[model samples]
Target: MFPLVMIASLVALGLLVVYYVGGYLFQNRSLSDIPAASPWAALTRFWLVREARFGRRYLTVDDAHKTHGDFVRIQPNHVSIANVNAINAIYGHGNGFLKSDFYDAFVAVSRGLFSTRSRADHTRKRKIVAHTFSAKSVMQFEQYMHQNLNELLRQWDLICQKAPANSKFARFDCLPWFAYLTFDTIGDLAFGSPFGMLKNGQDTIEYMDYPGGPSKYMHAVDALSRRGEAFAVLGCLPFLKKIGHLLPDSFLRNGVRSGSQVAGIAIARVGERLASTATKGTERVDILTRLMEGKDVKGQPLGREELTAEALTQLIAGSDTTSNTLTGIFYWLLKSPGVLAKLQAEVDTVILSPTDEVAFQTVKNLPYLKACMNEGMRIHSTSALGLPRVVPIDGPAIEICGRTFEPGTVLSVPNYTIHRLESIWGADSDQYRPERWESLTDDQKKAFVPFGHGPRSCVGRNVAEMEVTLAMATLVRRYDFELYQERFETWEGFLRKGFCCEVGIRRRMT
Candidate 1:
């Protein structure tokens, strides 16, 4: 009996090995033309998964693109393309390509605007809130931005004044501070009330205990950060999400908890806003009110669930992306003294007071300031990883990077790699030089997609730009930053998330 059991176990092990090897050989044969990032990458999705787990997926893919020509197989079926032309072909309107299943991992409540895969669904969702995100609409919300900006300045001023006994400069981490400002600003804009993150100088926020029950406080920013990292890893091969519970990885388990917390927060905010409107009958027009008034695909007001999803999307999209950009702007500014001086001079011309809330119109017109913003965005893109898209399984083969790829092939144009392409941005593409944006050719312009391109581009682009510019101008005009760390460290997630950026701030004498 023991001999017979051993023989069966040996047979099962041999069969599994044969299956894996056979499948690997078949995949290699099919994608024979494209170069693989590694031998294991051509065999399994686990290679990319491991890289993502370690927060080096973007960097690893970027290196592979540099080694291989235009395209590199980061996974068996997924190709990471460095060509700018592929952006339009893959993400442009009427381009047959659709968002891959990778996005489904990010669906916390429901498929929000950013996570939705269906073209029709995305179009419907876009129409519902398009006006709310327009430039004119964003302009209406400038007061909220200014309000938070003033609060941020007040806090910073106190810190600077209380600088260590004899030290002229005060030390603080800009990343969390920026996060607090953006979080409070977006919460006010979206939910009709600020989260008070800025005033408290913490990432904690209140959410519903139950319907009309009570409110609970949680570390909202930490959850969002962990969610980004977990989602980035799981999204690569969404199947992992199913068996994720069985896995012993603490990050994945913590991610699930974090996702639930974010979802609860969104639900509570939406519910509270709705309850306030119904009972108080206040006449205020904010993003939430507009969304409440907007019609859904069925020509009816959006349901609570749908509203929660969209509201949650706005909070996530508006906060980290803008904060990361602002952090990058300051990081690069402090790193390049010449650039910082030129930008400070430009900002000084427009900004009249240290405590004044810098207007968008004034800051928007500053050429050198705009250059630094563009350069910072280009060099330290928040969404550094490739936005993944898929060829239709039933449609004809599509062309990218002068190569024909069949349907069902995953194509990702990593912005990190594209922004640094030597052919388009010249040899100094890797350098953090604001002067590069002074004269951009048509080709270079096409490649500069910090917020992405096409119909699916960020609807909140106008708002994000306004917030980042306003905050950057205000801060740069008031204070001079000295870097505490020699190098800026970044972690990979859905967006290229930032770690702490510690710096010494002193009130500018001039």
Candidate 2:
């Protein structure tokens, strides 16, 4: 009698496992019309996770869009929509869409603007920090940009002189140079001082308080990025996440360790700023100071933790975005000689001295220069994957791609796929053509989402655009460059993904 009872219990357990394992299908039956990336995608997040693990998830989204039309099921509940029509519905302020919990993986402790899921919280934080990133406020950082770009040019000048006279070009990887320059710029803009990356030609984050000898802020961010890539893919699986936490002394922990190090740097910078200002009673002008001084809608200033998180957010987002966009712009320009020549002509016509810093105001309104920038940004989606946002649990059902999606459904639009779509862009969308911007109709222009669309769009975009435009025009005005390798390629990391190749550079001989 006891044995029979035990056998019956085992059978019931097996049945329950099967039902719940396949429950994703039954729950999402309303999404039957939507095409899945694969048969497995409907059952598990592992399929998408596999693409992410290989660092080709962007390709997966792009391939799915090509095969499945507009709406593709990336997971059982998650769908990727490429049409511009969904922009206002998903990301619009009044649309009631909230950022998905997927961003929770990025936050170290206290959630900042990038990862916070609470609408009220984000609204308050955005209100507090929004002024610091405004056009007028961002221009205050222009001097920092000029100083760093000049230092970068000085480094490249040294490399140019070091080149053998017989050689037509000097080989220098703009990848790290861009990184160094951007970090230094952000450092000076964030704290009262730069990281000295440009002066040193290396990523050096000095912490007088740190016990260990060397500190590279960019390296910490890189380590965090690698681990973020891993977590982003694998963390989708609940069992895998559980297993990850169980592993002792694993590489996964490095992400948090690196993030804490970055946090330490921000905290240290804040402390220094606070300390100097308090004792000396001197005013220090930087992003951190603004963050500390700014008040939320509640009229509450940021606490120490909140202040650190905001500072770290600005540094990471600003440096990576500017550096990567500049990298993409140069890569495209070098790959297309006619485009390069045209851009150079445009810049040369405007600038009296190639050696002087490219002033932001001078290049800000240049048509071809702006066109080149827009093209580069479109070709290389800064975010890579779709910026995922969820349908609010309490909001009304919405229609997308001729189907109704109830609350609790997930939606996103991958910038990479949308930017390269043949319908949105012409058949030559894959090609680098700055001139395409000139003929863009109202509909075509609406699809352009380099800085994203709506209120939730990147706050640091103004600063990023100004600095990139200035830096790119400056480089083109001063140097002639060619790709060192026969072909240019890059791996899509979590951030700063573009042009992982050496460029042969030389002073343009007039």
How high is the CA lDDT of each candidate model?
0.85, 0.77
Residue 446 lDDT in model 2?
A: 77
Cα error of candidate 1 at position 293, Å: 1.5
Count of backbone clashes, every candidate in sequence: 0, 0
Candidate 2, residues 1-510: lDDT per residue as tens digits?
A: 569989998998687556645667577888877899888777766677677766788888889889988899888888999888777678877888888767766675368888788989989999999988877788788887888888888899999987777897888788878878888888888887887877876665644233233544445436535555655654454345434555453554554455566666766777677777788865656688788889987799998778877887887788877778888778887887698889888888878777766788888999999999999888877667887888889978888657789889889988888888888798998998999988887667877887778877888888888888888898889998888765556666565375476889888755
Return the top candidate by TM-score.
Answer: 1
User: Which window of ten consecutive residues has the lowest lDDT sum in model 1?
Assistant: 19-28
Mind giving the per-residue lDDT tens digits that candidate 1 earns over 1-510? 569889998998687656655656764465767899998888777788899999998898889988887889888788888988888888888887889989988886678888999988888888898878766778889998888999998899888987898888899898999999999999989988788988998999876644465777789889888888888999987877776666689998788667767877888988888888789975666788878888867887777878888998899988978888898778888888687778888888878776666889888878888888999999998899998898988899887777888888888899998888999999988889988878999988989999898887998899898898888898888998788887789998877877889999988766
Query: CA lDDT of 264 in candidate 2?
Result: 63
TM-score, one value per model: 0.94, 0.91
TM-score of decoy 2: 0.91
lDDT of candidate 2 at residue 161, scale 0 to 100: 86
Each prediction's RMSD to truth: 2.9, 4.0
**Cα error of candidate 2 at position 427, Å:** 0.7
Tell me how far candidate 1 lies from the true structure as C-alpha RMSD in angstroms.
2.9
Looking at model 2, residue 456 earns an lDDT score of 79
**Residue 430 shift from truth in candidate 1, angstroms:** 1.9
How much is the lDDT of residue 18 in candidate 2? 68
